[model samples]
Target chain A: MTAIGKVSLRDTVFQRGRSKERSKLLVFNHTVLLLLTAFAVIPLAVLLFNSLKTELDIGQNPLGPPRTIVIENFREAWEEGDFAITMRNSVIYVVATITAELVLGGLAAYALARKRPPGSDLLMLYFLVASTIPVWMYIVPLFVQMRMMKMLGTFHGLIIIYIAGNAPLTIFLLRSYMIDLPSELEDAARVDGANEFQVLTRIVLPLTKPGFLTVGLVVGLGVWNEYTLALTFIHDPNRFPVTTSFAKFVDRFDTNWALTSAGAIIILFPVMVLFLALQRQFIEGLAEGGIKT
Target chain B: MAVLTQQKPTTVIEKLSDEIWRKKFLRNVIIPWVFIAPLLIIHIFVVAIPAVQGVYMSMTDWGGINPNVNFIGLDNYHELLFEDKSFGKSLNNNIVWMLFFLTVPFILALFCASMLAQIKRGGMLYRSILFIPYVLASVVTTTIWKNLLNPKDGIVAASARALGIEGFEVAFLGRTDTALMSIAFIDNWHFWGFLMILFLAAMQAIPPVLYDAAKIDGANRWQEFRHVTLPGIRPIVLFMFMMVAIWSFLAFDYIWLITQGGPGGASEVIATQLYKNAFQRFEAGYAAAQGVVISIFAGFIIMIFVMLRRRGWDI
Candidate 1:
């Protein structure tokens, strides 16, 4: 759009007098960015700080650094809120749902991506339209159906819902991944006396482990963090996942800010660790998932 | 002659084996369908059939658990339109929430993203820190804010007391006037960071040459942002706007967790109202109608996007 010479254009970034002005601009940029960053970060830090404080200390210094560093809140929450059992339940849901979504959705995605089964276009359109169907539209009937089938208050029931909800995500992402893969090896395996099942398992699955991993992470995080369905379906306290249970736990211990913060941190700890460890992948996957929505 | 006949017999055996090996029943149809059936059946059971069932349920007066359903055509719709006060209020609140989200997050994200875009150093630090809130669960996010907004010991009250700012120590969530705004503020705190990331990515994708071009034209920072940044990121921004508007109707977790749409139905939204009707009130048919309405609102937004695309708006 500009006829300026390339070197001059590049030089414009720090042109003599402009360097001082640019530096000042950089300071302004950092100040605003840092302030906004603080707006995001401070609350989390306070959550963490409050989690480690005594109830008395928090009452005195609610939003500030804790006067006493106490680790007892975590123990109290685990004991009182039943984090031990809830965490296990959450893990089971996450694992079962992710596995179901990946295996089943992967098979379907492979069929649609490469095999192009009859009515693939129709199936694609179904998913395309279904993805936009608000969960509220169907959730009531789904609940009714689950109730009729005696599936309400079950982990498997919730997992089934999670898998169904994530199918579009799994199919779209995995299909794209399958499409990207050079299919020469799959063909070679087919020629080498392998069945379609063998080719997928021995070749496609292995080579596309990254894609499966991404799907697993995305779906796993979703199921783990899910609330509304878990709230609706799993009414029994014994089977409540971390999210639903922690919600009730927070409300029950509403006055106990320290215990509440600790419980919240416990719920967030694993996700935060995984997020920080694989931020790029997490961000990429979230962006991908968000884009689809 | 006998040897020739023997060869013909062997050839016939070979032909029979080949026919069995290439059965059309298994190749083009059965195997592919096998791969597809599981996902299709599960999806149909969970989403499709139920969604279809919801259309029927919307017309009936069936409590969720009741086996008997009385079909009353468009009655729920009639009541929703004419008689439902909470529904009307919830719908209005949803619109108000949508307006806040559409403006507040967009402004904050655009400002923060543009600022981050200008500087290279520590951008990742700022980006990741800013994004941390977004990754946290709604329960956790709301809990953090609930403490931060606590009337007595929370940040606002503490700060006011410290700074001698009189009459600023109001119980934000407890007051009907401030409850919805407070919840929106908390939700926005957890939300705007996400939009910032999206905007930042879009901004970064804008070719530097465009900025150089703008600079060459003697465009100021505001002018450059208006011309270059806005045009470059318009698609994502507008798409996100549409989504936020749709999502406003479906807002549940934060409000449900924080207030349960309480303090005089102040922050009640469509999804919350739907939940209450379906489960709490046992008005499944009414809830189904509400759900359909929420879907219609969402579908209308989607339809607008689709129509705009069809009209060659390029968004």
Candidate 2:
């Protein structure tokens, strides 16, 4: 790497005199990138700053850094926003959806990728068409159906919807991954007196762990950040997820910027940490997921 | 061989092949379906059946409760198309939203992606930073922007005061004139970065040798981009265009969370109208019609793209 770097450096040095325009363009690139970065980040910085400020401080220094750091806004927002309940509810929705989606999606993907059963292609086509259908198309009838089944305002009900809503993406992504895996290991495992289930559990599962992780992250993020279905199906405040609950909190305290900022931070904190920690997975998975509701 | 009692075979080889076929049938067909059944059943019930029911319900006066028993055919659609003024306004707003999204984000993302592609150093860092907003929940994004656009104490007010500019601190989300566009701008802010990252990925995949060739041929940066980069990224660009056009019609969270289609129905879109009609007005049939309308619009966009593809557009 160092040798390659040295060679590139020497090449740049040799080309520097003739390619002054290149350096000028680099400056222009950095300037525009910096401005775009600021455009993306400054509002978030202000939110963080306002979260630390008091109402009085925000009144005076609204978009600037806080004059005094008041840690109590988080405490106040936490209690007032009922974040304890909402956060737990969101986690339950996310975790349950991921678990169910992985198990069911994994099974389905494995069958599609390896077994190649009759009509599997038809099923794949079904999911592809189903995925393109907007949620608005079915949300009203689904709400009535959920109500008829007495599943409204319930965590399991919401989880079931999330699992189903994410089924297409999950199956598509996991099947693509499983399709790339060599089948020799499974054939060898079959020779070792392993059943199909055993081959999947022991061989395919471990080999395709990264696929599961990617699907898990994408589905999990979708459930965590979901708003429309949560708002539609969950009328009970106590059962509300973080997204819906935060919207309600903002509604009640639209003018209280400090408290709202702190509330926003509370909701954002976990997502941000996870994003920064596993940005590559997050970015690639979401990009692959594409236009999720 | 002795347990091959399920089907009678006249010959030994016939029995042998029969046994193998049964085994393959069990292992391949039944088991796979079993594995797929749980999720597939649930998805079919949740999405498929309801979607089909939604089509039927749009023709009925279901009223969202009491299990009403009337099937009035196409009346709701008639009302939506001819009678409902708000639906027309909302559909118009959605078109405006679609137009803005198709143009602004594509141009912004393409320009920035090309610029970022030129840089070798800190490209990853810049990409990550820009993408941070996309990872954020819509709730959090709207909250941040809502405060920043607060006419009373927002950055606009503060900066305008500092610069001695008059009449600059307008309520962006308050007035009917600006509410829809302001919300679109905020949504775009959280959104365009994702598009930039996507375009950047596509740009990176164009093979550096193409750029080298372009440079060797005395091509300027813009010329190289126009010819090499754009053509290389055409498929993804076109695919995203269709997806964005579909999503623009389905856009709900940003507008709902920010304005709730308020300030005199300024930012209302089809989905928002559908939501209110179903939940608030208890007009399930009407809303289902709206939902179908939205789907028709999306399907229409998709069909156009399909037609383009069939015409050898290379999309």
Candidate 3:
């Protein structure tokens, strides 16, 4: 019970005071976070909830729980809405475009990273500048070109366009990741009697696998969900992507909430799965690519 | 033995020169060209050729199908700038859209990200939930909201009435005054998630040591935020601002699908205008001119951003 004991007691009281303040802060933080979460999730919840309700129920009660589950809406949306075809087209478009983008984008990135060739810096600058220009600027001329070349309504044309359109960002991301790789690895490979091609194939490509995966997943997600270009270029129903097909539900019919909601749910499932499967890489890639760029 | 050794040295020099020539040919000439060829070919056909043709088409009166197009220089620009009344309104709407789209969400995202940074649990869940809207295509989002905002029996209207707000049953998407704003709000809801994720990522990039130092210096949360977090995310904020501005100018999908610039051309932005002019009205030349105008504006905004970035603004 000396001076040291008294000081320790005072410190304990001060800590209690700090704890109280922290508790108050914590409550405030939680309230704000809860509000944000609600704000973010309400629309999705509404979509899901309404999809389970009949049209009469949705119109009459609006926000109340469904009187009965209606799984028929999804069946209707799938068959009549041509969702099967749209899904097939979407898969084709995404796979073809993503594959092309990764190969071309990765090769270009590898060359630029290692060679430091003359005007390589200028090439990178060109991509940066090109990214800022709106794709709409080229839409009309592209349409005309496609029409003239008899490539309109062809999957090849759309795939090629998608690849070229997404190339700038893909290359930019891969190059940034490539720049961070250890130069010594390439030097060591060269010392081991590897040519430039061997260095790229055996060493650089293998090392940059993470970057490739990140770019592929990101680009795949974008192409899968793309709408406007698909709407514009792909007029044939057989070639329409998921977005265009879903849009048809709205265009042809009145406000059939059940079917539209079901379509939305179907459309959302893949993207959600994609994000869930690659959540870590996606988040990391987004952080790295976005902040740096 | 001396003569043979001397000859060996000369022969070795010749072989080395030949090897150098072959390596140089492969490395300096072929590889770079090979690496760049695919991209260059695609660019030339898809981007460069169309760009040139788009400019060419701007001078003509092509209806997008006819082979023959009468050259009509600057007439489309004249109509858009001077004669067309809706064009001016659309332009003004675009300005408002750009401002709100870039600023409000950005400020809100920053605030949310900052608040979330103080929390320990469920941060990733919140982030993923917010980002859900961004992953949905514009068509799906617009469709869902259109149904939700239905004037007569839509959930939003019903809910508003349930809360005792009179006249909340108004046809939000049908009227001119509210249509643009309503569309903008939906766009905000759809897009804010991405911005939140960006801000959150940028926030995480900030070192914890800065906050620790600020705390030791007797800074409270708000003060530390102002002194530390704001400065840390300034570059991202600036970059997002520029991007949002560009996106606003180019935005078409949601507006098109939701309202079709309708209730008589109320929510039309430049991109929508270009689309209507080209596809609906069959004014390909006029649309091309409008496209050029949009491109020039985009070019101006990008130039400013690039100049600022060069001056260390980080965008």
lDDT of 2 by residue, B1-315 (tens): 356565678899997898798898899999999999999999998999999999999998888887665999999999999999998999999999999999999999999998888777788899899999888899999999888888888987778988999887898989999999999999999899889888888877776667666766878878988999999999989999999999999999999999999889999988988999999999999899899999999999999999999999998
Model 3 reproduces a share of the real contacts of 0.51
Candidate 3 segments whose C-alpha is farther than 4 A from its true place = A1-16, A191-197, A287-293, B1-12, B309-315
Report clashes for each candidate as comma-separated counts.
0, 0, 0
Show where candidate 2 strays beyond 4 Å: A1-14, A291-293, B1-6, B10-16
Docking quality tier of model 1: medium
> In model 2 chain B, which range of ten residues has the least summed lDDT?
B1-10
Residue by residue across A147-221, what tens digits does model 1's lDDT show? 889888887788888888998888998888898888798889878988888988898888778788888888887
Q: Which tens-of-lDDT digit does each residue in B27-130 have in candidate 3?
A: 85578668867975786688767877888888888999878778887777788799988778878889989888877888788888887776566777777776
User: Which candidate number maximizes DockQ?
Assistant: 2
DockQ of 1: 0.56
Top-TM-score candidate index: 2
Mark the 10 consecutive residues where model 1 chain A has the least summed lDDT. Answer: A1-10
Q: List residue ranges in candidate 1 displaced over 4 A.
A: A1-9, A12-14, B1-25
| lDDT leaderboard ranking | 2, 1, 3
* Per-candidate interface DockQ score: 0.56, 0.63, 0.40
lDDT of each residue in A223-263, candidate 2, tens digit only: 88899889899989889999999999999998999999999
TM-score of the second chain of model 1 compared to its true counterpart = 0.92
Worst 10 residues of 2 chain A by lDDT: A1-10
